[model samples]
Structure formats: C-alpha cells, structure tokens
Target: QIVRAGAPYYLPAKIAEHVSMVGELLQFPRLVPKKVISVGSPVKWANSCDARGCANLVTPSVIAQRYKLPDESLPAAHQAHTSNSMAVAEFQGQFWKKSDLDGFGTSCHRDVSVAKTIGDEEPHGGIESELDIEYIKAVAPEIPLTVIYNGQFSLLKWANQISSMADP
Candidate 1:
C-alpha cells in the first residue's frame, strides 16, 4: 500500500516506477479506490490525507525565494517588479512581438545527450560533463546558467536532475 503511494521509505533510488507500471499494465486504476462501508481489518488508502493550502505547506524561506527581486530592479521594487521592468517591455516589443510563438515550442522543452568520455578527459572544465553543458547552452540560449555534475555513487540523483533543470 505504501508502494502504491509512490513513497520511498529509506532511499531515493527506489524502483517505484516499475510498481506503478505493473499497476497500470493490470488496469489497476480502474479497479481500485472503492470506498468501503465496514472495515474491521487493517486497511489504508494511499492518498488519504488532510488537504493543505499554500499557507499551511509553504515555508518562510520558500516564500522569500518565490518573491525574490529580479536581476534588475524596475521603477518600483514591488511584487510586480519583474512585470514592470523596462527591459522586459523592450524585449517584448522588439524580440517577442516579432517572433511567431504560435508554434514556438511546448512549455517543457528538453534535450538529453549522454557522453561516454572519461571524467579526466578535460579537467579544466567543471565536474559537469562538457557535452551535457554544451547541449543545454545550445538548446536554451541567452539565459542564466548553472551546471551541476554528480558522481556515480551520489545518493541524491533527484538533486542532480533538479540542478540541471534549475535555470528553466
């Protein structure tokens, strides 16, 4: 039942994907979630929990980060600072207006490339794989960039993925 909730109790590298895949393969979504009338035996619904709002769930640090100031301050440093930036207006007028985003791209655009090159091939560049960094640069041009490379034995693979997608 805990596996059904996609909860990894100890490690982040749990294979919950396979479990979910098997559940889907067996048409479990259509079969499960029938609320019962009487239950003397031990039973638990995976997603049974109190509903939470942003006020209850968010932290002070998260609030600060979410409402952080833009790179360049605008006319007034209010909540609408980014929206009121002159640069944004100019960018919108010159670049955004001219470009046809009718079929520009989807909200989530990603390109993943793997390299088998040895780690010590180029020590001058940071730990991040050069091929991967270059791929991201070419794909998402003219934006703030941060690259994070992880060792093969690192525990938090999710953090590595998050760092790669940090800019976007």
Candidate 2:
C-alpha cells in the first residue's frame, strides 16, 4: 500500500492506481536472501563478531592437535596475529546476511574457491580464512561446511566482472 502521490496533488484516484500496481507486482517472484556460515582469521573473526576475546576460543594448533592434522597444515598459532583471542560470536550469520560486509557485497557465488593462505590472493571473508575453519571445527564440529576460494582473481577484478556482467 505505497502511495507515491503527495499532499500537493492529493489525488485519491492516483493513489489507488499506485496501490493496485504495487499489489500486482507483489505477486511476482521476489528474491529471498540465503543463509550460509563461514569462518575467518582470529582478528577478522573477532572484529566481525565484535567479540573481545574470540582469539582465545581456538587456534589452528588446537585443531591440529585435536584432529591429528599435519603440523604444516597451518601457520604458527603463536604468531602475533594468532595469539589469544575471542571466539567469533554465533549470531554473526544473521548480521552478515543483512550487512554489506564492508563493501564486499552480500551475495555468494560458487565460482570462487577457498585458499589455505591469504598471500597475493583475492580476499574472501567466509570459509576462506583458516582460523575461521579452525574455530568452526572447534566450536561446532557437527555442522557440515563447504569452503570456496579462487586465487586467480583479485577482489577488485572479481567485483568489477560481476558488476559488468550484471549491467545493461
């Protein structure tokens, strides 16, 4: 029941027309947001979750020890970036679904691949971050997870391509 006409015109007939148009359009297919979970580095996870002590939740070293993964599977957990930190809050999924995600956009495409390292590679926030994976495994091992990453494309290039393809 949206009315585009203002008081200056105060045309009741026009308001009815606008309402009818809106009602008709409502019957068309509407886009509903999808929900997915992801993990990230301790600092990134903490900052995203706005939790102060997320780093302390878990580390790659802990995951390695718990799951018997190879020592080379992750960077040193004691590094300045991996030190004691708070765990990413569980409520992040809802926030992320509605958030612009620091201008990275809200859509997730399957075309990308997840990488083990962040060097020279396009940055992805979800499952691409190693610490994020470790935290997920540590906090909730029961939930199935799928990680995607693509090292060939830079973030800006990927965004540009998506934008261009969508343009008229």
Candidate 3:
C-alpha cells in the first residue's frame, strides 16, 4: 500500500507520468490499481523502539499535538490533506504559482521572437543586451518591462557545489 499524505511540496506530477509510460511500453494487459491510504493524523510510536527510525513514522499531527499547533491552522499538521497522490494513472498538479522565476531567479518563460531577423541583427538581439526597448514599448505600450535571466543550470550547479560541502 502506498501512503501519500503530506504537504504538496513533497508530491510531484512526474511519478504518475513515469508509471503510465512504463506500463504502456511494457504492454501490460491489465494494470493493478494500488491502494492509497491516507491517515488523517500522523502516527506516533508508543514504545522507544527505533526500527524504521524515530522520525520516519512520526506524523505531523503528533508533532503539532506535542508542540501545540493552533487548531485552525493545522492543515500543515494534518498529513493526509496535504499531498495529492495517484494509485495508477493520474497525478497531482503543480503546487506553486507558475512564476517567471523560482527562488533561484531563473526565468521560466521562453524567448519570444519578432521577425526571423531585424536590422541585420538576430531577431532577439545578442544574449547580454535587452530587446530593443523603444521598439518593444511601441509594440506593447502598456506593459512594464524587466530583464529576466535564464540561469537555471547555473543556479543548479551552484546549489550542487554548496550541497557537496556538507558531505563528509
């Protein structure tokens, strides 16, 4: 049995997609639907035995109860209501708003081109320079403009480097 009860951040859409793809590729005649059990309250161990690890099974509810989390704001404490899970085919949608950039300041929008080429320059101009501000202003008069950096890979590389330092 699969248990998917937690905050939306921990659940991703790719898991269900991958499972579907694998089943299709393998040509499974009948796919078995798995049971997804969501426990409303987090489980806590009564004894001090550490088989699976002390924190593994300890639910957010138990933490909230012990630490006294507010009842009205206990959605974060209630593990089952947080996560979206699929037993066989479907998956959960993105939890965060689709922003132009993530916390790392990487642009999510793709480059929009005008013509194939403009004034002997590439349509979007050189990478470092901003798009022709006056031309864009004339075309899109009302919109406030800002430059966004497409630096996802660089951010990831920096994150990896920082994470590696924690290794023994």
Q: Judging by TM-score against the true structure, name the best candidate.
A: 1
Lowest-lDDT window of 10 residues in candidate 2? 105-114
Per-residue lDDT of model 1, residues 9-123, tens digit only: 4324466543322212122244567798885865322221122432333322233335572322233422342222111101111212101221112111222222222122222
lDDT of 2 at 158: 40
* Quality of model 3 by C-alpha lDDT: 0.30
lDDT for each residue of candidate 2 in 1-168, tens digit (9 for 90 to 100): 443434343338858765422222122345587866766554422122323453554443345456775444235522324232232221112112112332221121111122222123332344334344444533333333333333443444444433454321
Say what the RMSD of model 2 is: 17.9
Candidate lDDT scores, in order, read: 0.30, 0.34, 0.30
By descending lDDT, how would the candidates be arranged? 2, 3, 1
- The TM-score ranking, best first, is 1, 2, 3
Clash count, one per candidate? 0, 15, 0
RMSD of each: 19.6, 17.9, 23.2
Clashing pairs in 3: none
Q: Name the lDDT value of residue 111 in candidate 3.
A: 22
